[model samples]
Target: MKSLLLSVSITASLLLSPLVSAKDITPIQKKQLTEISGLLRDNPELINPLHSNLKQYLDGQKSLETILKTNHDYLYNNPQQPYFGAENPKLTIINFTDYNCPYCKRLESGLVGVIKKYPEIRVVNVLLPFQQRMIPGLKTNTAWYALNVWENDHSKFAEVHRLMMAKPSRHDSSSIMKIAELTKTQKDLTPNQKKMALVEKNEQIFSQLGLRGTPSLIIGNEIIPGFIPQEDLEKMIAKQL
Candidate 1:
């Protein structure tokens, strides 16, 4: 059996899918191609004439790669939302994180620690929160509350992210205010009554994306679900780097 825990620990040790490299395919694409080729070669029943099919797939891949490489700018040419590393916009990582969720916080720290060690990497923070009816319009209404609290400030989001993973929340509004103060949240918007509608809209978008968990990440065209360790993330990041 595949070690589910090991996979989660490694994957959640942190994240994956693709990298924004100027040349070559992303890590996720490379891994996918490798797996597909392996299965095709190994399984006679799956591909009785594996060699013929493999060449065909490779040819198709090359054509697709060429087309994408030439047209990528037009394909994804939107002013992307940015976060922590916006000032240093080298290679960007878009993270949909929740502070209330423990795993999301864990992965956030691992990545942050990586950033501290390597300041060149740029990470964007998208405030995808997990919320509720009581705090109805905070953001996403899922288990992860920290992300909700984070909407008031991105840096606070990062701070609370680190705290929630290593320690339990007092699990109250006070915790929100405390983190807001500690992290110097921008505008004190957390206490604003009028921002509810905006928060609801944000939550709506999170739901629309079909995400049901904390830390649903987007790196280039790659969509990664859940938290992973730094080592796994580094393996993915190496391609872009």
Candidate 2:
């Protein structure tokens, strides 16, 4: 254990060195950090500093990975996915969110604000309701409702999304359906077969990406998880562009 701590300290030092940038951490170091993160997950004492360094390294490396591994055709070009903003956008942000997540709601507002400011950015919103630990089954209904609305009439999506996020109510099917009715999207989904299938597909996509949780975003090659300020989001977009 002492040897392990020494190794992590050494790696952390390298990350902090004046000459060593995020890109300087080679593939081997990434693997090492990843392993250490997993091993230290149960050790609360050592996890904080280790995770901080790991996050720094990951932030630097994700852009490069995005360039190499991003499936633009699947994420950006797919006609079936719902997106908003400039038709011809300089940057695209693939956002994974859940209606049940407070952080997702916060991020949603931030994203909308940013989009309004920078009309050249496009946002592809993906629903992953089950990602929230606070509310489990309720996410299915909200995700289905949102997707149903998008599938039926994308023109109404923006309004429906805002309503769904804005309505202060408990996370449940009844509340979700009420919001849908208010948004005039209740009729868009019934029998729940097609919409539920699409919801499942979205869930699968989220899982396949190995995303950590709601409010996660794919901006270019960088995977940003959790709620980030609108200003920071703009900066990330600017960096990509």
Candidate 3:
């Protein structure tokens, strides 16, 4: 027993050795980080930082193991999952995004390639309900108008979303006009007065979610705030497959 214990200790130390980074990471490590982020909900200890006294299921589990047991809410009540990938494929990715978020735009840039890699994957998006609240005043109203149009006609939403992301302005008139042309909701869109009213309604739903910022993500069961590495996400998704 004594001999066996000594051998295991040696193995653990070697594996846990510090991961050195010159600029703090190698190109490969940097890349791995992108795809390695996973939902570790089932492994309760992960949430230990947030929840004290949580039991550890780690049991010498490697720092990076395919997390098999994320909370059901992570999968069931996901903010995004634009489509379904439950059974069709194991690689499913959801981005909980706001149109105005810079990080969300950054993530969007990498999304096209990720989708191409896994044809069977489902990349659903959960519209962050309160995205417009970041901007104040009439701009907020215009923001709501855009969202309403997208929600009312989802088929053309992807285009509208891209248009909103293209520019830096938040709920401005020029932006609204551009989106209107793309979605062509000019006549059907709520009048300016109605748009303002609509935004107020949307703000309530956002507040209820407890979302504090834009570009927040519900990757698997992992709640990653702001910009994240795509490679780490890729690895997490690949394991499921």
Candidate 4:
């Protein structure tokens, strides 16, 4: 009985492993899975914990969906949010990004491609600088600087945003301020209470949605967390359209 329980636990863990996919399973593994499935059927109580955990996860996801729906206007249509794409778009997706996150950097090109392909879609940029810290000379935060540039001068925001995103390493106050200077957004880089408030608001919304990390996206009613490939992104957008 003890050995049987151990096998069940191992099999369950293996089944749940992200590294193990259907195509990777061998014939012997398939036979083992079949045997495990039979065991699970016979001893239904063995799976109660797994079932309960899965139910909890699904419930949490549903709750997040509700939150997203509730805050739809503030997230997608707020005038304060900096966005790129069509001036008047049929679809709008919100991006929760951190300047220092490499995954967010990787996802940037994909997002740009999506925008180019779907001229009627808009992507709102929500700066959540989780990894940034205050530098001595810079009066404001890196993300806050970007937000300020966007608000004060919309024309320079794109170049400022691009320079920051293109940095090979994490952005410091100096690097960000240099980009601001280069783009002539330095004048607006002074600390602004309103931009700080907007950044805080974005963080609050990110928390409300239960997002774990940067590069998360909101497409339609679905809240996609983490980096998504351009091809898959297009597919998701197509479905929405």
Residue 238 lDDT in model 2?
82
Model 2 misplaced stretches (Cα beyond 4 Å):
1-71, 131-140
Give the count of colliding residue pairs in each prediction. Answer: 15, 0, 15, 0
lDDT for residue 18 in candidate 4, whole number 0-100: 44
- What's the TM-score of every candidate structure? 0.53, 0.68, 0.53, 0.77
lDDT by residue (103-127, candidate 4, tens digit) is 9999999999999899999999998
Off by over 4 Å in 3: 1-89, 129-131, 134-143, 191-211
lDDT: the better of candidates 1 and 3 = 1
> Per-residue lDDT for 1-241 in model 3, tens only?
4443334334333332332324546576555444322322343443334222111223323222232233334433543224433346455565556676677777776666566776777665555535455344334443555556655665776677677667764556666666777677765355355445444433443344345665655454344556766786677567556
Predicted structure with the largest lDDT when compared to the true one: 4
List candidate 1 stretches off by more than 4 Å. Answer: 1-82, 131-167, 180-198
TM-score of 4: 0.77
Question: lDDT order of candidates, best first?
Answer: 4, 2, 1, 3
Name the best candidate (by TM-score).
4
TM-score of 1: 0.53
Return the lDDT, model 1, position 15. Answer: 28
Candidate 2 clashing pairs, residues 3+ apart or interchain = none
